[model samples]
Target chain A: MSGAFEIYRRWLRDRRRSTIVWSVSIAAVSVVTAAFFSSLGQSLGENAESGSTTSSMLGLSDGIDPQTPTGFLWAANYSNQLPWLMMALAIALGTAAIAGDEADGTLEYVLSKPVTRSAIAMARAAGMVTILFISAIVNLVAVAITAPLFDLYDSVTITGADGSTSTASGLTFGQLVVGGLAAFAVALGSGAIAYLLGAASGRKGWAMGGASGFAVAGYVLYTLSNVTGDLEFLTWISPWRWFIDDAMMVNGLTWDILWPFALTVVAVVAGWQLFLRRDLQN
Target chain B: MTVIEAQGLTKKWGDFAAVDDLDLAVGEGECYAFLGRNGAGKSTTARMFLDFLRPTSGSVKVLGGSGADPEVRSRIGYLPGDLNLPPTMTGIEAVHYFGSIGHEPDTAKVQALMDRLGLTADRPFHQLSTGSRRKVGLVLAFMNDPDLLILDEPTSGLDPVLQDTFRDMVIEHKQRGATVWLTSHVMSDVDRVADRVGLIDQGKLAQQLSMDELRTKSTGNITLTFPDAPDVSSFDGVEGVSNVQVADRQLSIHVDGPVTAVLARAAELGAVDIQTEKNDLEDIFLDTYSHEAGR
Candidate 1:
């Protein structure tokens, strides 16, 4: 096997237990939440009509009807909970990609071999992304399996902006794909930032703290912008804005999903360059 | 032929030089032991040989090529002083993992080493004893049968039997024309295996001498205890006696050559007891390093 793949495989094998735990935890939570939507059907519809705090917090803005299965699942689970968990997992993996091994003194020994430093960095980052993707896929599969058992596949009624009402079936499988894609993008972008920090500093604390701080700052900026007209421009830089503005699960695929992927690619390139120039910490 | 060469090698951290203008060479089939106190730049110099750290100044050549080249690295085996492996991997797994980086490992040889070193292959590295961990490191280093072996404190945590086994392995590798460069603060570990010794102090090469040369320069010592304080200055200005000290009824004499002159002088002084002590590598090592402060 090539050295890069060898290292990548080792990382995957080593992290197998942690990856299984994270994936199962997220998937189980999603399935349980979906199962609850059946019993909460009437109450959630009443809250959506009255515009309760819980409704707003779930991002049930205009055009989204919580009475429908798609809106209920997206609002109650995907919007806030799933993305946060994925972001946490991604960031943790990214921090461990380089800085964690460096701290533990494993990276130095690995680099002593005939393999190039870039190979090690890139392989480790790829391993982190693979786990993130697996977590998202696992959650997607669980929700899909449980959504129908809760009667979430039925037809739905919708009202247009012209005050006209219409009836339509639930969202298609394509919508589920776009929704999962959006979540994956958000998680990857944040993780890439952590990866960049780790590559630049070779310090796990710096990577973990810096990336988490950036994520929090972006969320706060996006939240405050929604409350005031003057701060609306700040939402442009927030990942939350891109994810929430288009309501990817309800709406079809949009250009906003591409933003995170672009940011991730850039982070990977910049991180590789930074890592190539610095000295390995002993 | 010289398998390893460094000229004007220097590594500095800010204003402090870890290694300063060092020059060294190890010929093929030669076991050159690098002797130094802690922080004397032994590891830093070794790091440069494997391109783990770039020199602030000067250059290093290994196996007649730049150490940074993968082709050059493929022919060298290195064991860092502080060995750390992935905590979850077993010894056998580590062997295969590191082997893939260089060449296909000879499993038979690996098993032989495991048996010889008394290492259990199934146990995870973190679960192994310190000696077992060192065994894993040794197996990994010698698995590829590289042309050059750069080991830093190769036998640090090993038991006496294992240390002797390690010395025998180095001797066998040397007979096959492999160049070995090892660093150690302990004299006994290297004194048996090394062909030449280089003493480093304060990141500088203080002395480099072959075993034969050192034997000639540092002769044995003889102490004569007389019945009384008879002619305390009897051995003073003796031709072969380089150092002498008189205390009570005992006279300690350090000789630079054959003990004939000192033995003759001791008989004339009516010595009641005579004890001869050979000059050991530890004494020479201490003399070179005691001047430097604790690093």
Candidate 2:
């Protein structure tokens, strides 16, 4: 194998146990989430079709119609939750890419190899992104499998209150796939940040601490930006804002989507440079 | 041609100078031993040679290139004093990984070294005992058969049998014209294998001596047991005798020169069970360091 692929393979082998745990957990969570949301969406659709009030069907008011499309119900109730879940998974898994090696005293051995320090950082970040992408695919599969079990099949169609029709036909799977890829890219950026911190500190605990602190700080900034008129610029700097704002799961992918990917590339390059220049004490 | 050269080599950590204004050169096919107490900067010097640590205000050239150049590194094999391998990797796997870095998958060299050192390939690094781990380090250091070999305490955990085997391996490498630089606390190892030895004390080169010269210059000890405690005072002013001790029936004298004078004195004392032993490297090493420290 070439150096890059060799590094990639080593990372995969190192994280094989974590990957198994994450895959199983994501699969379980996906199945439960998909089932719950599919059932809720089907119930709302039935109420809308029966000429009942949508509010009562959603348990928000009395007498709701049951003719609503299951796709509309699912989108209304679950679409926003995807970003939060994806962000949490990305931060947890991606942040460990560099930090874990430093903590375990393996960074020195890795650096002693012929591979450049920057390549070590980039290859590990890429591995984390790949793992996150695979997790997203597995989650999407679980959603697909469970959605049709609750009468939320491809044929269901419902009109929104705005008179816009939504259906499983309008759900572009390709767009969702691209959205997942975009989320993976954002994860790579987070991983790069963590890798740089790990390389600078030469301590796994410090790296993880810094990454966790950054993630929390990013979320707080995004939330504050949304709530306050001032400090609005925080949203642009927050990775979470970029992630949630750019998710186009059911909508078609856009060229504007390139912004997050570009940001990821920048973060990765910066991290690699920092890692290359730092002295690895271990 | 010199395979490694260091000029005015110095390394400092804040106020502490780990290596100070040191200069050394190793020619092709030469085996040089660095002798010193712990923390005497042997490892620091080696690290500087490998460019693992940048010198404060000096330079090191390896194989006719700057220490930091990959080309120089490609031609040298290094065993760090704190050589730690990844715990998760097997011996073979770890060797293979390092080989990959060197841009070749020479499993045969690794296997040959392991066989010579009796290192098992299936053993995980953490599972190996300390001696076995040291063997693994040795195998890694010599597996590449580079033009220059830099090792620190290379035989630390080796058993006597394996130590002999390793010595033979070093000799084989030397025969092929590979320069070997090693450090060890075992004076016998250095005395047996090193053509020349550099003694360092407190980060300073105290003395450099060839094996034959060191042996000839070192003090010898003579122990004599008498049937009755005869007057040992007569031997006190004898030539080449530095110190004399008289116990109830035994006399011990530290002598520097030909034992014939001390032997004649012993015969005059009507001494029985006379025994004479030359000062080995241990005595010379202790005296050398103590003297250097005092200076």
Candidate 3:
């Protein structure tokens, strides 16, 4: 167990520079996006009322107002930029867990030590997850520091289904935390897929390409299903459905967020089994 | 006691056999040199001993245990043919990182090795030259003072000085009762240290012999300066004389063993000047391969 931890710590140290760069870059983008909320808040209702096709397609439908801090944060950051940034980080880190090191021939040396393949696998996965969590936490802390200044805490006016108007309270601290966890879960799922591909194939490019393709396909499938009722069943396969359709940040929480987390577990097991059984190719 | 043992070891990749059924053994404190050309399964065999590659069939035992066992691997020091280190890590960091994998390495020993190899401890791996990278590998492999050393082409990128240092280090370890198995294209390194040499060609063990046996296998040539161009066939049937040729006033006879019969024939030819040149290991190596290929 200590040997595995040692491997974990060494891998984290190896990825130190990359972790810092990705974390800071993602945090900076989140902070800058939060800065635009005040001005955008003023025209939020008009933009939705204008019946902009773009807003509807982006899940910014009438029910999701860009005026509130939660809605704006979700639309501007979490919905697109935040999840995409996290996915990019996850894929890069996940592919590197095995495929990258195998290609570089470093994994063989590491494995030559008095450590089991299972220990090394668990250690690498742990390191990758830690980095992903750090990036998510950076984005969350950046948003927390910048949210109040944009009047993101003020009560939000949410019109009901029967033309009744009501003000929903300001974005609560709990909601923001839950929202961050949801985003992290989504990234974790995507990264796990990449990790699985890398461990199974021992090819970095395959992992990167396969995971990225899965993300794009999930998005296209989910959005097209919304645009066409015929493909609605495909939404279950898209992680986007659990993230956006449930309106995790705005409407409080639901079981949808757990899907990605569950997928992450399954992927890890599958990857571990594949890695242990196969040869470490050069 | 045998420290290394393999029985019917075979490794195949689809239709291609990287290593065929082979049985080998290396006794404690013996220096066994594995010699083969490129793509000759030397590195593949080494990898199997470390469990980096699983065997298709058969078994290899190291230190009386399976190579796949961590306890067994902990006692072995391995240097791969292709040494790769993370570009971001300095030599100092690598020493610490790889050293922590098993029992702690002696700091003084590591520093001494670095000094002897002329490696820059603070330089990142990518900044180091090819020879310097090999130096780092040597330091890492020798750090733990392991019981068995499996080095593949250990002196490939080394300078002549470093190569000599490596040879001395191996000899010192052997003196201390460590078993050494290594592969190298530099026959001199083998000629100077190997107790036994195994020649592998096209995934099969072609020949296995001791250093003295290898020396004896070399063909010695006798050059005789005659008064005039003599008939080469005049000495053809002489014992141990072959490929006899006469050029100008000189007669050349190739002898595989004792030169007594050739010397007698030369005396009968009334040769004024006679010279005998012995073949080295390099000649024997080439001869073995060519002879195998011819079959």
Candidate 4:
């Protein structure tokens, strides 16, 4: 379509400033936290205990030793702070892609052009992906370049609670990449829900609120279930359960990473189709 | 050829009708003015023609094709009642972006329009004043010189001078065989641009008139005064006159069709003072609706 490329290109151009700000700001947190990880010294092991709210905040999974380089990197940055903020960025992009324009009447004006609604929907989705991918790349680069400087790439030996010792491996590039990809996946999945809501109802506030609520509710459910061990069965539905289960930085490339990618495909198709059948709000 | 057509077109939200059973056709090279008060369904009907809102139980065609067809849309320029673009978009970006997406708009023409409307490219759309935004809309609508133009309240925020300028542009477009379907309550603007007028009330079209017919029906209020109180019954059954109300020394009379006959009648009744009130949208609506009731 004649207008589709221009719309997509224009959307990306419009998103450039925000994407840079969000990516840099989030990566700054990751790097700053990673830089301070060495300062914590032996306190890392005490912070890694599971089954508490504090443990949930650190995204501590069972059997992981935060005193180790891989565990500290996972617990300190990639597990909670990185994925959570990245999810926010993705949600923003997804909601802005369709519902934001529609609410403000830009989508209506664009429809007056010689482009199909499908073209606009597809272009917006593509634009969202482009900006999100850029954000993920910047975050990965920031973490990768700063990892060794913070001793995240060095192997460490931790004394067990039983007084036995074992050597822990350093964080590899492959594991780092997997960690970044997993975070990106979780963020994209949250964003897809936002996209679906925005497209289904051309209301920006609703989309943003619903998607944010979904993310917060999922995390809360997972955290509460982890502590109580009562609603453990319910934790299956939350993305946080799978994300924290594998903690890809600690355990590289698990099948649970497949959840978000699948949901993203469904969201793109459903959002686009739903948007086509709706009225453009003035 | 008919450039725009709507057959039994209707739009309803639940049970509340925004537009009801409207059948309309605008020929090529003609200017059709759709006149209505706020919430009278002018915008809703226009939206249906552009496929922004689907009709409940009718069909609409633009240039002999569905508005959903890109090819049909490519030959049209539309300006919404409330023009909104991306807030961060400057007028230059809007012109380039909107200009390119459809037909290859004439660059020279676009420049001329911007100059004529005094629209600048420095400010983003949200930062611009309402009038400035309307200017951007006018430029976009005219830049393409499309086969059909559907403008909703196109001159609401424009100053009188710019409104006149807009009328000139619409006339020019009509001269070039572009069909224009515009909705405006500004009679002066509509009087200059519309070849025909359709009056709508409460979502149903009450009347449609050609410019010639409307000119003939241009009714007004003529206030006449005599030294003493005039008898209201004295002016009864007067030709081209109605609604004669005598208050103290004044006789407020409504003159329809021709004022000449009423003037002659007033002179015989010893009127000392006379005043004429020109017709506005409300008067037009009353006149048209009354005629409909009579029919």
Q: Choose the strongest candidate by DockQ.
A: 3
Q: Residue A109 lDDT in model 4? A: 90
Model 3, span B1-295: residue lDDT tens: 9998999999999989999997899999999999988999999999889887888999999999877777887888888999888888898988888777776688999999899888888999989888888898888888888899999999998989889999999999999999999999998899888999999988899889998887777788888998878996878777778888888999887898877788788789888999889898777778768866677
User: Can you write out model 1's per-residue Cα lDDT over A97-117, one digit (the tens) per residue?
Assistant: 998898888987887777878
Clash pairs, model 4 backbone: none
lDDT of 1 at A209: 97
**What DockQ, between 0 and 1, does each candidate earn?**
0.63, 0.25, 0.67, 0.66
Q: In TM-score terms, which candidate is top?
A: 3
- Specify the highest-lDDT model's number: 4
Residues A130-181, candidate 4: write the lDDT tens digits: 8778888888899889988988888887787799988887778787788889
- Evaluate candidate 1 and give its CAPRI docking class based on DockQ: medium
Candidate 4 Cα errors over 4 Å, as ranges:
A50-57, B220-238, B242-254, B258-282, B286-295
Q: Which residue runs of candidate 2 sit more than 4 Å off their true CA positions?
A: A1-5, A40-103, A110-129, A136-147, A150-170, A228-230, A250-256, B103-109, B225-233, B236-239, B248-250, B257-273, B284-295
Extract clashing residue pairs from model 3: none
Q: Sorted on lDDT, highest at the top, how do the candidates line up?
A: 4, 3, 1, 2
Model 2 C-alpha lDDT versus the unseen true structure: 0.68
Candidate 1 Cα misplacement greater than 4 A, ranges: A41-57, A157-168, B225-229, B240-250, B256-260, B267-273, B293-295
Docking class of 4: medium
Residue-wise C-alpha lDDT for candidate 2, range A1-282, written one tens digit per residue? 265567777777766777767766765665565555534655655554554233322222222223333234233432334444555556555555665665555655455444555566777777877777777777667656665664444555666767898654433456445645655555555555566566555566666676667766776766555545458765677766644443344343566566656766766676667665544554
Better of 2 and 3 by DockQ: 3
Q: Is candidate 1 or candidate 2 better by lDDT?
A: 1
